[model samples]
Target: MSGRDFTERDIHMALDGELPGEDRAGYEAWLAANPDMQARRTRYAGDAEALRSAFAGVLDEPVPARLTRAALGEKPVVVERRRPRWWLAAAAALLLAVGGAGGYVAASLGGGSHDDSAQDQLAEEAIAAHVVYAAEKRHAVEVPASDLDHMETWLSNRIGMKLVAPNLSDDGFQLVGGRLLPAGGHRAAMLLYEDAEGNRISLFVTTEPAAHGKGIYAQSGEGPRAVYWLDKGYGCAVVGSLPDNRLSEVAKRAYEQLIAGMIS
Candidate 1:
């Protein structure tokens, strides 16, 4: 099959190793020829690996006696071979059942860390996106800022929230462009900006809520600093290599505009 014959679904299936054997080679060649798609596939693979890593302990632990009894229910259950995604979903559900409400309650009750894993995942994704795309000079974003309207519409539709690239001219950064990204289990929109000095910042947005105790939190100690915040419609993290103060300024501007967009 020609490159044009491969649809978005086919690419994802290929990434998941679910594509038919006959069509896999053609899609593989297509992905090899397309750097952007190849990058996307890499991101998806990374996400899958991260998921596996997060629950690695579960694989070693024996199933709880009560859970086994509840599932068996006096009848033998035959386990069927399933896709990796299905296994990941099943593992996640099992984990929640084992850990309970993402360990918040268990942690609180046990006097352990009360950090929100979902918000941490969001920040991790945002930083990862920035590290991968911000360094690119030619293909930083899938859509250029010159086509702002289309970029806005496409990302908004895919991410399930009306998205507008926040104005940051006051902070000396201009919109460079934006792109769609796989953010764990959520579809994410990333808006890239550049300053006169050639420094870049990316605002990663997702419809999934990422609120924790801190309304807006700044991540410290890393290659890049990130400021994450939650909105009624979506959550966003502004990531850049700039100083903490500078990054916070950019994040504040983005937060105001995003909140205003939701209000109006």
Candidate 2:
């Protein structure tokens, strides 16, 4: 904590309250000198709050009988035992929530759209949009599929990330159109696509700078299977009723095209 400049490691330590008393003052001083990092600190604070809210109810849920039996081990039960599976799941969710400073998935293990974190909310919104629009007889999208170029250019500007409407024709799907939605207190883009059978899928993209580090993650919610990933300062999820394997394949192809565009 002396001589060398404060590192991101130090900031994380200070935020987590793991910094020692001797080093704490120095870290705080460093943070005070750098206004830009205040945003990062704020995010950490918000992540802590979100984690608390998401997991608070787990304590009150009834413990599974199997878990209680495991703890009791044939002994006559005296006090109530906790659910082993639930504890493990809660621990994982906590790790997800704080691990990325709240930009990544902190999804509820239950089949619900109320997880309330950035990535969780994005995936939920994506699935919700897809379900609502996919059933449309008409007016499935705000922008028509014919205006692919304008949709790409306009959305790229509004969301502050380069956009590409990945063509899914090889997989028997084509772009239907896209629209803007709200995510993480900012604008997110939702692109819809359809196959010959009229089965629809949606791609939701948002600005999430501190999302999952260096890889993609997939989650199945109540409605659809969503494969999500963060790349080049943005996060996106592909939501559909396709089998998990098929969804993964589509997500992989879309991811490749996006990365290629970024590289080019």
Candidate 3:
């Protein structure tokens, strides 16, 4: 065992098979000392394989005319960018190993640059997911709170990070459950919590690679109020139907726990 502390991002890289061989050995040793992490790794490995198998067909499809034309500079066409989003959803729903898990479509649009791309894409998908799932009463989540352990593992595998649902009871929201959603070239894990009054909140998390964001970015749109923050190379957003004050407090608490839980 290396006896070194590994950050959540390190775990993600390991899961995605992006870790250097030396680092991969060390991470495996770390998982040996941590049984929970070992189990998480096993589950994640399966999830990754399943995702690849599910989307294997897309690789065989002929390139779309617009993409081909744009590549050759033959046409000035602005594609809607919605096609790939649904393919992601289709893969998630067809997760045979994790049967009956529904997924939400997430489209990644153009951001400022490579630095801002991941953050902006994650934020837009987070809000879009919250808008879609928060309205569901019967099927609010794919894996309910009862299966939170598995949900965490599933999401970690898909998103290439380790995770725990941050406690929100202190913030007046009880854990409802969470689902793994599609995020363009990435993936997202959405945790849904509900207040006693039935208001729902979502915490969206994914690894924010490349450029780190500044401070928290807060905004409100037609659907939900949201506060997004990047900490320790992870991108997270707190979104809810509550007012700015309530959402801000919730975001603060989530941020603290997220920071505290960073592997190193």
TM-score of each: 0.55, 0.54, 0.55
Q: Give the Å shift of residue 232 in candidate 2.
A: 4.1
In the range 1-264, model 1's lDDT, one tens digit per residue, is: 534577668767876778888787798888788888888888888998999899999989987554675676753232232223443343333334434322321222132132355555677789899999999999999999999999999998999988878899998999999999976656899999999999999999987653342222334344775567543546688888886556666777887798777556
The order by descending TM-score is: 1, 3, 2
What are the per-residue Cα lDDT tens digits for candidate 3 across 1-57? 355677656767887778877676788777788888777778878999899999999
Best-matching candidate per TM-score: 1
lDDT of 2 at 245: 55
Give lDDT per model, in order. Answer: 0.71, 0.68, 0.68
**What TM-score number comes out for model 3?**
0.55
List model 2 lDDT by residue over 173-221, tens digit each.
Answer: 8999988876644578888889999888888888766444322233433
The alpha-carbon lDDT assigned to residue 46 of candidate 2 equals 91
lDDT of 2: 0.68
RMSD of each: 18.0, 21.0, 20.1
Spell out the clash pairs found in candidate 1.
none
User: Which portions of model 1 miss their true places by more than 4 Å?
Assistant: 1-115, 213-222, 231-233
